[model samples]
Target: MLGRTMYALISLSDLENDFINPYDLTTRLNRFVAVEYGAQFVLTAALLFTGKWFLGVAQLLLTAFLLHSWSVRQHVVDATDVFRQLPLQKKRRLIMFGAFLFCFVMVTYRLIESIIHGLLTDEGRETAKKLFQDAAASLHHY
Candidate 1:
């Protein structure tokens, strides 16, 4: 699932050129902003719900700035242009590798966190369970 999400992010990046019709600048900008902002917002909300409030707010602010910053946007566009110059097969391979790396890192991170929690928080077991329940309930906003 994480790999799929990473693939979507890579494929939907503004750097990916049209194998079909050309997209206008406005359309490209809108799509990029929507995807970047939407993903960041969801990530921020998830982090906050899972009890990482500071990290969530910091990420939210940073991503908000990235969304608004013309320089950052142009930098991404430039990076994507470079990526677009790659051969199709190479591009596919790179994206797949990226997805795998992301998935592995995320899974490992979560596993480590779970292990640490298990070792350190025996008294908070019930609290953790309630927190997860609340987090799941919050997802109904979708």
Candidate 2:
């Protein structure tokens, strides 16, 4: 979605060549950002409700990063005359990128933790064996 916007901004031209219309651009950006926020907010809440605290907090960090990035984008675009915060805006984008990477790490950590937890203990070994048997049975059906 962000790529589409950038492509449009580059390929399309306005009188001033900054944007077709600042307000219209702002509105479109706001709509997508708001929808993304709404979806993630629901996901975070659902995760917490399901007692997935670690995952919920990780998801929350991603959500906050996206929301903050959107706000910075709006601020950059909503400037009346000339927005001279290019460096600061770049920093915000960097932070957003970092947030995505960190979220990836968090998920990987959780996956490894679960796999380890499911491997060491006796009960976990039985559970894992059961899972494999069930999975094999299901595969045989196919």
Q: Highest TM-score, which number?
A: 2
Predicted structure 1: lDDT: 0.53
Collision pairs in model 2? none
Against the hidden true structure, what lDDT does model 2 obtain? 0.59
lDDT of 1 by residue, 50-136 (tens): 987656666556555545553544313333354553344234435435544654576589789888686766668777778889999
TM-scores, each model vs. reference:
0.35, 0.45
Worst 10 residues of 2 by lDDT: 7-16
For model 1, where is the 10-residue window of minimal lDDT? 20-29
Mind giving the per-residue lDDT tens digits that candidate 2 earns over 15-132? 1466455556445434555555676689789988999897788778877776766666633344342234434444554554565556568878988988888667898788887998
Cα RMSD, each candidate? 12.5, 9.2
Q: lDDT winner among the candidates?
A: 2
Q: What is the Å distance of residue 2 in model 2 from its true position?
A: 11
Q: What TM-score does candidate 2 reach?
A: 0.45
Assess candidate 1 and give its TM-score to the true structure.
0.35
- After superposition, the stretches of candidate 2 with alpha carbons farther than 4 Å from their true spots are 1-31, 61-76, 79-85, 116-142
Model 1 alpha-carbon drift over 4 Å, by segment: 1-33, 70-107, 116-142
